[model samples]
Target: MNIVVCMKQVPDTTEVKIDPVTGTLIREGIPSIINPDDKSGLEAALVLKERVGAKVTVLSMGPPQADLALREALAMGADEAVLLSDRAFGGADTWATSTTIAAALRKLGFDLIICGRQAIDGDTAQVGPQIAEHLSLPQVSYVSELELAGDSVVVKRTFEDGYQRIKVKLPCLLTTLKDMNSPRYMSVAGIFDAYKKDVQVWGLADIVVDEANIGLKGSPTRVKKSFTKGAKSAGKVYEVDPKEGARIIVEALKEKFVI
Candidate 1:
């Protein structure tokens, strides 16, 4: 089996800051890490590789800093890593990002594509399905359990109500949740090896991507405005007897028209 895992480098949630002036994420000088849920997806790919003796390749799309995430994957047992970076890819929304990744996947040709259910920062939960649509591949999202049976893939997918088991053919896309697996830590030797390993970097031109359908110009949605979520302090707390506390709660509710 030839498996591909899509990973992302995201800003540390606590360190992330939004530029009030440009209405964009301020990434300069900020710490970056692999999206947490993507670690589970990478683990799933590694497990699959071990079970089926497959070649696992990790792919990521981001700025040059994203090479760090790829190197980390290499240390975690991925056979190879590919970095897709270009200035033209900046400010792309989920649609454009998915399109770019799908095109890259087409170039690589894979039997399966694994990705996190959603990125930590964005949490849009749209890219995986969007890539599936772009590739015209069968897709299952929020997968918790996965198994390979002959040429088919069986997956347990989580929905609002509960989980549903489904089977899909090869060349499918699965977006995995954190509950899927526990990611293994990289060994000291693996870390040292990854330090000397070279990650393949590809640009839009290298992938032979159409300029019109990728990056900022190819995106239909534009960021008309961007702003950081306002900080909110905790509300008041009351100290009183049970009866007094009930009265206070009622009064506050009435004041807010909640009663």
Candidate 2:
């Protein structure tokens, strides 16, 4: 089986701080990590590799620094890694990002493509489906479990209420949920091997991308503004008996039309 895993490097949102005065994200001291759900997709790919002797390739589109994320995927047993990085690819919304990835996949053919349900930084959950749209391939999003069965793969697709078991043929795409599988930690030997491996970096020249849809020029959505919700200051503090508290809560609910 030939599998391609899409991965991303994102700032650790937990460590992300916002400036009070500037009302902007403080990225200076933030550390970057592989987007968690994307790692789950990699883990799923690795499992597929073990099950059917598949060769796994990792692909990511980001700045040149994103090569680090690809190398890390290599350390996790991916056969090859490709980084799509170019100035033209900068400031891309998910539409542009998925377009670039779809182009890259055309250059690197695959029997299956796996991606995360969503990136942590942008929880829009649009890129995977967008890639499927761009590639004109069938896709199953939010797959929690899967198994290989002859020529087709059976997937347990997840939903808010429950999950459905469906079989999809090869040349299909899947967006994996966090519970898809357990991601393995890189071994000492694997970590050392990653440094010795070479990750292929591709620019705009390497992939067949529509110039109008490659970057910010093609993105229709842009954050007009980003600001953290300011914390509410101290509210009214009333010392009262349990019965009085209950009455106050009921009145407050009625006032807010939440009753």
Worst 10 residues of 1 by lDDT: 223-232
Can you write out model 1's per-residue Cα lDDT over 100-218, one digit (the tens) per residue?
Answer: 99988999889999999999888998999999999999999999999998998999999989989999999899999988889999878889888888898888787766778888888
Cα displacement (angstroms), candidate 2, residue 72, comes to 1.0
Write one digit per residue (lDDT tens) for candidate 2, span 23-61.
888999798889988999999889989977999999999
lDDT of 1: 0.89
Best by lDDT: 2
For model 2, state the Cα shift of residue 8 in Å.
0.7
**Model 2, TM vs. native:** 0.94
Q: In terms of TM-score, which candidate is strongest?
A: 2
Candidates' lDDT values, in order? 0.89, 0.91
Candidate 1 ranges beyond 4 A from true positions: 15-30, 233-259
